[model samples]
Target: MTTETTETTGTEAADIQAIKEIVATVQRTQRAKDPEGFLALFHPDALWTTGHGKVLIGLDAIAEFTRAVLPAANWEGEVTYEPVHIQFLRPDVAAVKVRQVYRSAEEESEGAPLYVMTKRGDGKWLLHACQNTQVQAG
Candidate 1:
Protein backbone atom coordinates (compact mmCIF):
# COMPACT_ATOMS: atom_id res chain seq x y z
CA MET A 1 0.00 0.00 0.00
CA THR A 2 1.03 3.56 -0.61
CA THR A 3 1.75 5.92 2.23
CA GLU A 4 -1.20 8.02 3.34
CA THR A 5 -0.46 11.43 4.76
CA THR A 6 -2.79 14.03 6.18
CA GLU A 7 -0.67 16.88 4.88
CA THR A 8 1.80 17.20 2.10
CA THR A 9 3.74 20.28 3.10
CA GLY A 10 7.50 20.41 2.68
CA THR A 11 8.11 19.85 6.38
CA GLU A 12 5.64 17.00 6.47
CA ALA A 13 7.30 15.43 3.50
CA ALA A 14 10.68 15.63 5.21
CA ASP A 15 9.22 14.07 8.34
CA ILE A 16 7.81 11.25 6.28
CA GLN A 17 11.18 10.58 4.76
CA ALA A 18 12.83 10.62 8.16
CA ILE A 19 10.25 8.17 9.50
CA LYS A 20 10.83 5.89 6.55
CA GLU A 21 14.54 5.92 7.27
CA ILE A 22 13.86 4.89 10.84
CA VAL A 23 11.82 1.95 9.58
CA ALA A 24 14.59 1.03 7.24
CA THR A 25 17.03 1.12 10.11
CA VAL A 26 14.76 -1.25 11.99
CA GLN A 27 14.95 -3.76 9.18
CA ARG A 28 18.72 -3.46 9.02
CA THR A 29 19.19 -3.87 12.76
CA GLN A 30 16.87 -6.86 12.93
CA ARG A 31 18.61 -8.58 10.06
CA ALA A 32 22.00 -7.98 11.62
CA LYS A 33 20.76 -8.93 15.08
CA ASP A 34 22.07 -5.65 16.43
CA PRO A 35 20.01 -5.14 19.55
CA GLU A 36 21.62 -1.83 20.47
CA GLY A 37 21.02 -0.48 17.02
CA PHE A 38 17.40 -1.52 17.12
CA LEU A 39 16.87 -0.14 20.60
CA ALA A 40 18.37 3.17 19.58
CA LEU A 41 15.36 3.83 17.36
CA PHE A 42 13.06 4.09 20.34
CA HIS A 43 12.12 6.83 22.73
CA PRO A 44 13.26 6.60 26.33
CA ASP A 45 9.82 5.71 27.62
CA ALA A 46 8.71 3.77 24.61
CA LEU A 47 6.14 1.05 24.78
CA TRP A 48 6.53 -2.03 22.62
CA THR A 49 4.41 -5.11 22.11
CA THR A 50 6.02 -8.11 20.43
CA GLY A 51 4.28 -10.14 17.75
CA HIS A 52 3.72 -12.90 20.31
CA GLY A 53 2.05 -10.39 22.67
CA LYS A 54 4.79 -9.74 25.17
CA VAL A 55 4.56 -6.19 26.42
CA LEU A 56 7.71 -4.15 27.02
CA ILE A 57 7.43 -0.78 28.64
CA GLY A 58 10.23 1.78 28.72
CA LEU A 59 13.62 1.65 27.08
CA ASP A 60 15.08 -0.37 29.94
CA ALA A 61 12.59 -3.15 29.53
CA ILE A 62 13.04 -3.12 25.78
CA ALA A 63 16.81 -3.28 26.23
CA GLU A 64 16.49 -6.27 28.51
CA PHE A 65 14.31 -8.11 26.05
CA THR A 66 16.44 -7.26 23.05
CA ARG A 67 19.64 -8.33 24.75
CA ALA A 68 18.17 -11.67 25.64
CA VAL A 69 16.36 -12.50 22.44
CA LEU A 70 17.95 -10.85 19.41
CA PRO A 71 21.38 -12.51 19.43
CA ALA A 72 19.87 -15.86 20.33
CA ALA A 73 17.08 -15.81 17.75
CA ASN A 74 17.29 -19.04 15.77
CA TRP A 75 16.47 -17.82 12.32
CA GLU A 76 18.10 -16.78 9.10
CA GLY A 77 16.20 -14.38 6.91
CA GLU A 78 15.91 -11.10 5.14
CA VAL A 79 13.42 -8.73 6.73
CA THR A 80 11.82 -5.79 5.08
CA TYR A 81 9.67 -2.98 6.41
CA GLU A 82 7.50 -1.00 4.08
CA PRO A 83 5.57 1.95 5.28
CA VAL A 84 2.00 1.30 4.19
CA HIS A 85 0.47 4.39 5.78
CA ILE A 86 1.47 7.44 7.75
CA GLN A 87 -0.96 9.74 9.49
CA PHE A 88 0.27 12.91 11.11
CA LEU A 89 -1.53 13.30 14.41
CA ARG A 90 0.25 16.58 15.02
CA PRO A 91 3.24 18.43 13.71
CA ASP A 92 5.44 16.31 15.93
CA VAL A 93 3.56 13.06 16.23
CA ALA A 94 2.58 10.44 13.68
CA ALA A 95 1.03 7.03 13.42
CA VAL A 96 2.81 4.78 10.92
CA LYS A 97 1.56 1.46 9.60
CA VAL A 98 4.20 -0.92 8.32
CA ARG A 99 4.09 -4.09 6.28
CA GLN A 100 6.88 -6.37 7.51
CA VAL A 101 8.07 -9.47 5.71
CA TYR A 102 10.65 -12.06 6.68
CA ARG A 103 11.93 -14.40 4.01
CA SER A 104 14.11 -17.41 4.72
CA ALA A 105 15.20 -20.41 2.71
CA GLU A 106 12.36 -22.49 4.07
CA GLU A 107 9.45 -20.06 4.17
CA GLU A 108 8.24 -16.51 4.51
CA SER A 109 6.19 -14.76 7.16
CA GLU A 110 4.54 -11.40 7.52
CA GLY A 111 3.70 -8.92 10.20
CA ALA A 112 1.67 -5.75 10.47
CA PRO A 113 3.15 -3.29 12.90
CA LEU A 114 1.74 0.05 13.97
CA TYR A 115 4.26 2.52 15.27
CA VAL A 116 3.38 5.70 17.07
CA MET A 117 6.33 8.01 16.67
CA THR A 118 7.14 11.31 18.29
CA LYS A 119 9.57 13.91 17.11
CA ARG A 120 12.13 14.91 19.68
CA GLY A 121 13.26 18.45 20.29
CA ASP A 122 16.19 17.69 18.04
CA GLY A 123 13.75 17.03 15.18
CA LYS A 124 14.45 13.30 15.24
CA TRP A 125 11.55 10.88 15.09
CA LEU A 126 11.68 8.01 17.55
CA LEU A 127 9.37 5.08 18.02
CA HIS A 128 7.12 5.68 21.01
CA ALA A 129 4.23 3.28 21.23
CA CYS A 130 4.42 0.32 18.90
CA GLN A 131 2.68 -3.01 18.36
CA ASN A 132 3.95 -5.87 16.21
CA THR A 133 1.32 -8.36 15.14
CA GLN A 134 1.99 -11.48 13.13
CA VAL A 135 -0.17 -12.05 10.07
CA GLN A 136 -1.58 -15.54 10.02
CA ALA A 137 -2.12 -17.37 6.79
CA GLY A 138 -5.73 -17.92 5.96
Candidate 2:
Protein backbone atom coordinates (compact mmCIF):
# COMPACT_ATOMS: atom_id res chain seq x y z
CA MET A 1 0.00 0.00 0.00
CA THR A 2 2.77 2.39 0.94
CA THR A 3 4.70 1.74 -2.25
CA GLU A 4 1.60 2.07 -4.38
CA THR A 5 0.72 5.32 -2.67
CA THR A 6 4.18 6.68 -3.27
CA GLU A 7 4.00 5.76 -6.93
CA THR A 8 0.63 7.43 -7.33
CA THR A 9 1.88 10.56 -5.63
CA GLY A 10 4.92 10.68 -7.86
CA THR A 11 2.84 10.26 -10.98
CA GLU A 12 0.50 13.03 -9.91
CA ALA A 13 3.42 15.37 -9.26
CA ALA A 14 4.93 14.61 -12.64
CA ASP A 15 1.60 15.14 -14.40
CA ILE A 16 1.15 18.54 -12.75
CA GLN A 17 4.68 19.52 -13.68
CA ALA A 18 4.10 18.49 -17.28
CA ILE A 19 0.90 20.55 -17.38
CA LYS A 20 2.73 23.61 -16.07
CA GLU A 21 5.47 23.18 -18.65
CA ILE A 22 2.85 23.06 -21.38
CA VAL A 23 1.34 26.30 -20.11
CA ALA A 24 4.74 27.96 -20.04
CA THR A 25 5.55 26.69 -23.50
CA VAL A 26 2.29 28.02 -24.92
CA GLN A 27 2.99 31.39 -23.36
CA ARG A 28 6.57 31.52 -24.60
CA THR A 29 5.70 30.32 -28.08
CA GLN A 30 2.92 32.88 -28.51
CA ARG A 31 5.12 35.77 -27.40
CA ALA A 32 8.14 34.76 -29.47
CA LYS A 33 6.61 33.25 -32.62
CA ASP A 34 8.41 30.00 -31.96
CA PRO A 35 6.50 27.62 -34.21
CA GLU A 36 8.82 24.65 -34.16
CA GLY A 37 9.55 25.21 -30.51
CA PHE A 38 5.86 25.37 -29.73
CA LEU A 39 4.90 22.41 -31.89
CA ALA A 40 7.50 20.31 -30.17
CA LEU A 41 5.27 20.31 -27.15
CA PHE A 42 2.22 18.97 -28.97
CA HIS A 43 1.14 15.50 -29.93
CA PRO A 44 0.96 14.43 -33.55
CA ASP A 45 -2.83 14.53 -33.63
CA ALA A 46 -3.28 17.62 -31.52
CA LEU A 47 -5.70 20.41 -32.31
CA TRP A 48 -5.41 24.17 -31.84
CA THR A 49 -8.14 26.78 -31.91
CA THR A 50 -7.45 30.48 -31.58
CA GLY A 51 -9.52 33.19 -30.02
CA HIS A 52 -10.45 34.47 -33.45
CA GLY A 53 -12.28 31.17 -34.00
CA LYS A 54 -9.68 29.73 -36.32
CA VAL A 55 -9.13 26.04 -35.96
CA LEU A 56 -5.96 24.20 -36.91
CA ILE A 57 -5.92 20.47 -36.64
CA GLY A 58 -2.76 18.34 -36.82
CA LEU A 59 0.86 19.49 -36.85
CA ASP A 60 0.92 20.68 -40.44
CA ALA A 61 -2.04 23.00 -39.99
CA ILE A 62 -0.66 24.20 -36.68
CA ALA A 63 2.65 25.11 -38.27
CA GLU A 64 0.94 26.97 -41.05
CA PHE A 65 -1.26 28.86 -38.67
CA THR A 66 1.65 29.81 -36.47
CA ARG A 67 3.68 31.06 -39.40
CA ALA A 68 0.84 33.23 -40.58
CA VAL A 69 -0.16 34.71 -37.27
CA LEU A 70 2.90 35.04 -35.06
CA PRO A 71 5.38 36.56 -37.48
CA ALA A 72 2.92 38.84 -39.21
CA ALA A 73 1.99 40.71 -36.10
CA ASN A 74 4.32 43.40 -34.83
CA TRP A 75 3.79 42.62 -31.19
CA GLU A 76 5.95 44.69 -28.89
CA GLY A 77 5.05 44.12 -25.29
CA GLU A 78 5.03 41.68 -22.41
CA VAL A 79 2.43 39.02 -21.65
CA THR A 80 1.43 38.33 -18.08
CA TYR A 81 -1.22 36.14 -16.44
CA GLU A 82 -3.16 35.68 -13.25
CA PRO A 83 -3.95 32.12 -12.29
CA VAL A 84 -7.69 31.38 -12.06
CA HIS A 85 -7.86 27.59 -11.92
CA ILE A 86 -6.28 24.39 -13.10
CA GLN A 87 -8.72 21.50 -13.19
CA PHE A 88 -7.31 18.04 -13.71
CA LEU A 89 -9.63 16.05 -15.92
CA ARG A 90 -7.27 13.13 -15.84
CA PRO A 91 -3.71 12.44 -14.89
CA ASP A 92 -2.76 13.36 -18.41
CA VAL A 93 -5.29 16.10 -19.14
CA ALA A 94 -6.38 19.37 -17.56
CA ALA A 95 -8.30 22.58 -18.11
CA VAL A 96 -6.68 25.87 -17.17
CA LYS A 97 -8.33 29.25 -16.81
CA VAL A 98 -6.40 32.45 -16.38
CA ARG A 99 -6.62 36.21 -16.76
CA GLN A 100 -3.92 37.25 -19.17
CA VAL A 101 -2.52 40.77 -19.34
CA TYR A 102 -0.68 41.70 -22.51
CA ARG A 103 1.10 44.94 -23.07
CA SER A 104 -0.80 46.83 -25.70
CA ALA A 105 1.26 47.48 -28.79
CA GLU A 106 -1.44 49.77 -30.16
CA GLU A 107 -1.13 52.12 -27.20
CA GLU A 108 2.18 50.68 -26.02
CA SER A 109 0.60 50.06 -22.64
CA GLU A 110 -1.04 47.27 -20.66
CA GLY A 111 -4.36 45.49 -21.06
CA ALA A 112 -6.16 42.61 -19.40
CA PRO A 113 -7.23 39.53 -21.33
CA LEU A 114 -8.88 36.36 -20.17
CA TYR A 115 -7.77 33.02 -21.58
CA VAL A 116 -8.80 29.39 -21.34
CA MET A 117 -6.43 26.52 -22.08
CA THR A 118 -7.09 22.81 -22.32
CA LYS A 119 -4.34 20.23 -21.93
CA ARG A 120 -4.09 16.79 -23.54
CA GLY A 121 -1.72 13.80 -23.82
CA ASP A 122 -0.18 11.30 -21.46
CA GLY A 123 3.54 11.98 -21.20
CA LYS A 124 3.46 15.71 -21.82
CA TRP A 125 0.63 18.17 -21.62
CA LEU A 126 -0.26 19.50 -25.04
CA LEU A 127 -2.52 22.51 -25.48
CA HIS A 128 -5.74 21.17 -26.96
CA ALA A 129 -7.50 24.53 -27.10
CA CYS A 130 -7.22 28.17 -26.09
CA GLN A 131 -9.56 31.12 -26.18
CA ASN A 132 -8.62 34.71 -25.49
CA THR A 133 -10.92 37.66 -24.90
CA GLN A 134 -9.83 41.28 -24.72
CA VAL A 135 -10.67 43.31 -21.66
CA GLN A 136 -11.92 46.82 -22.17
CA ALA A 137 -10.24 49.61 -20.26
CA GLY A 138 -12.45 51.13 -17.61
Candidate 3:
Protein backbone atom coordinates (compact mmCIF):
# COMPACT_ATOMS: atom_id res chain seq x y z
CA MET A 1 0.00 0.00 0.00
CA THR A 2 2.81 2.41 0.82
CA THR A 3 4.52 1.63 -2.47
CA GLU A 4 1.31 2.29 -4.37
CA THR A 5 0.85 5.61 -2.66
CA THR A 6 4.42 6.62 -3.38
CA GLU A 7 4.04 5.73 -7.06
CA THR A 8 0.87 7.76 -7.31
CA THR A 9 2.57 10.77 -5.75
CA GLY A 10 5.46 10.45 -8.15
CA THR A 11 3.12 10.29 -11.11
CA GLU A 12 1.32 13.42 -9.98
CA ALA A 13 4.62 15.26 -9.66
CA ALA A 14 5.57 14.27 -13.17
CA ASP A 15 2.22 15.38 -14.46
CA ILE A 16 2.68 18.77 -12.85
CA GLN A 17 6.05 19.17 -14.48
CA ALA A 18 4.61 18.23 -17.86
CA ILE A 19 1.90 20.80 -17.44
CA LYS A 20 4.48 23.47 -16.63
CA GLU A 21 6.34 22.59 -19.79
CA ILE A 22 3.17 23.14 -21.77
CA VAL A 23 2.80 26.60 -20.30
CA ALA A 24 6.39 27.38 -21.15
CA THR A 25 5.77 26.24 -24.70
CA VAL A 26 2.81 28.56 -24.85
CA GLN A 27 5.01 31.49 -23.98
CA ARG A 28 7.61 30.47 -26.52
CA THR A 29 5.14 30.04 -29.35
CA GLN A 30 3.45 33.32 -28.55
CA ARG A 31 6.76 35.08 -28.61
CA ALA A 32 7.65 33.49 -31.91
CA LYS A 33 4.21 34.12 -33.40
CA ASP A 34 4.08 30.50 -34.52
CA PRO A 35 0.39 29.85 -34.82
CA GLU A 36 0.72 26.20 -35.74
CA GLY A 37 3.06 25.54 -32.88
CA PHE A 38 0.66 27.22 -30.49
CA LEU A 39 -2.31 25.34 -31.90
CA ALA A 40 -0.59 22.01 -31.46
CA LEU A 41 -0.90 22.31 -27.69
CA PHE A 42 -4.69 22.20 -27.76
CA HIS A 43 -7.12 19.31 -27.88
CA PRO A 44 -9.09 18.84 -31.08
CA ASP A 45 -12.34 19.68 -29.29
CA ALA A 46 -10.95 22.38 -27.11
CA LEU A 47 -12.82 25.56 -26.30
CA TRP A 48 -11.02 28.88 -25.99
CA THR A 49 -12.08 32.36 -25.07
CA THR A 50 -9.74 35.15 -26.02
CA GLY A 51 -8.92 38.08 -23.83
CA HIS A 52 -11.05 40.26 -26.09
CA GLY A 53 -14.08 38.01 -25.51
CA LYS A 54 -13.92 36.09 -28.78
CA VAL A 55 -14.92 32.47 -28.39
CA LEU A 56 -13.27 29.77 -30.44
CA ILE A 57 -14.50 26.20 -30.40
CA GLY A 58 -12.66 23.20 -31.73
CA LEU A 59 -9.29 22.95 -33.41
CA ASP A 60 -10.52 24.38 -36.69
CA ALA A 61 -11.81 27.57 -35.15
CA ILE A 62 -8.71 27.94 -33.07
CA ALA A 63 -6.47 27.42 -36.03
CA GLU A 64 -8.35 29.91 -38.11
CA PHE A 65 -8.30 32.55 -35.42
CA THR A 66 -4.65 31.99 -34.59
CA ARG A 67 -3.51 32.07 -38.16
CA ALA A 68 -5.40 35.26 -38.74
CA VAL A 69 -4.35 37.15 -35.65
CA LEU A 70 -1.15 35.82 -34.15
CA PRO A 71 1.11 36.68 -37.02
CA ALA A 72 -0.40 40.07 -37.46
CA ALA A 73 -0.28 41.10 -33.85
CA ASN A 74 1.80 44.22 -33.51
CA TRP A 75 3.69 43.82 -30.31
CA GLU A 76 7.38 44.49 -29.91
CA GLY A 77 7.88 42.78 -26.63
CA GLU A 78 8.70 39.65 -24.75
CA VAL A 79 5.88 37.51 -23.45
CA THR A 80 6.06 35.19 -20.46
CA TYR A 81 3.71 32.60 -19.05
CA GLU A 82 3.97 31.21 -15.54
CA PRO A 83 1.81 28.49 -14.05
CA VAL A 84 0.53 30.07 -10.88
CA HIS A 85 -1.66 27.23 -9.65
CA ILE A 86 -2.79 23.73 -10.52
CA GLN A 87 -5.79 21.83 -9.22
CA PHE A 88 -6.37 18.19 -10.01
CA LEU A 89 -10.02 17.68 -10.70
CA ARG A 90 -9.39 14.03 -11.47
CA PRO A 91 -6.48 11.75 -11.99
CA ASP A 92 -6.37 12.71 -15.65
CA VAL A 93 -7.67 16.24 -15.52
CA ALA A 94 -6.24 19.46 -14.12
CA ALA A 95 -7.16 23.12 -13.98
CA VAL A 96 -4.14 25.35 -14.37
CA LYS A 97 -4.03 29.04 -13.67
CA VAL A 98 -1.42 31.00 -15.56
CA ARG A 99 0.01 34.46 -15.13
CA GLN A 100 0.96 35.97 -18.47
CA VAL A 101 2.99 39.10 -18.94
CA TYR A 102 4.16 41.06 -21.94
CA ARG A 103 7.00 43.45 -21.40
CA SER A 104 8.48 45.88 -23.86
CA ALA A 105 10.82 48.82 -23.53
CA GLU A 106 7.86 51.11 -23.33
CA GLU A 107 5.24 49.26 -21.34
CA GLU A 108 4.04 46.07 -19.74
CA SER A 109 0.74 44.25 -19.77
CA GLU A 110 -0.61 41.22 -18.01
CA GLY A 111 -3.14 38.48 -18.64
CA ALA A 112 -4.80 35.93 -16.42
CA PRO A 113 -5.58 32.72 -18.15
CA LEU A 114 -7.17 29.54 -16.87
CA TYR A 115 -6.47 26.34 -18.70
CA VAL A 116 -8.28 23.08 -18.15
CA MET A 117 -6.08 20.28 -19.36
CA THR A 118 -6.70 16.58 -19.79
CA LYS A 119 -4.23 13.78 -19.92
CA ARG A 120 -4.86 11.48 -22.84
CA GLY A 121 -4.71 7.71 -22.65
CA ASP A 122 -1.37 7.93 -24.42
CA GLY A 123 -0.03 10.01 -21.49
CA LYS A 124 -0.06 13.42 -23.13
CA TRP A 125 -1.67 16.49 -21.66
CA LEU A 126 -3.62 18.85 -23.92
CA LEU A 127 -5.47 22.02 -23.31
CA HIS A 128 -9.19 21.22 -23.21
CA ALA A 129 -10.85 24.44 -22.15
CA CYS A 130 -9.26 27.82 -21.68
CA GLN A 131 -10.11 31.42 -20.95
CA ASN A 132 -7.69 34.33 -21.41
CA THR A 133 -8.51 37.52 -19.60
CA GLN A 134 -6.59 40.75 -19.81
CA VAL A 135 -5.68 42.40 -16.54
CA GLN A 136 -7.10 45.88 -16.66
CA ALA A 137 -4.82 48.62 -15.49
CA GLY A 138 -6.14 50.64 -12.58
Candidate 3 residues 29-128, lDDT tens each?
9999999999999999999999999999999999999999999999997998988888888989999989999999999999999999999999999999
Give per-residue CA lDDT, model 2, range 27-72, as digits (tens): 7877887777877865667676665667778778878887777777
What pairs collide in candidate 3?
A: none
lDDT per residue for candidate 1 within 2-74, as digits (tens), equals: 8777759999999999999999999899999999999999999999999999999999999999999998989
Candidate maximizing TM-score = 1
lDDT order of candidates, top first: 1, 3, 2
User: Local distance difference test, per candidate?
Assistant: 0.95, 0.60, 0.91
RMSD values for the candidates in order, in angstroms, are 0.9, 6.7, 5.2
Candidate 1, superposed: residue stretches over 4 Å from native: none
Candidate 1: which pairs clash? none
- Which 10 successive residues of model 2 have the least lDDT summed? 1-10
Q: For model 3, where is the 10-residue window of minimal lDDT?
A: 1-10
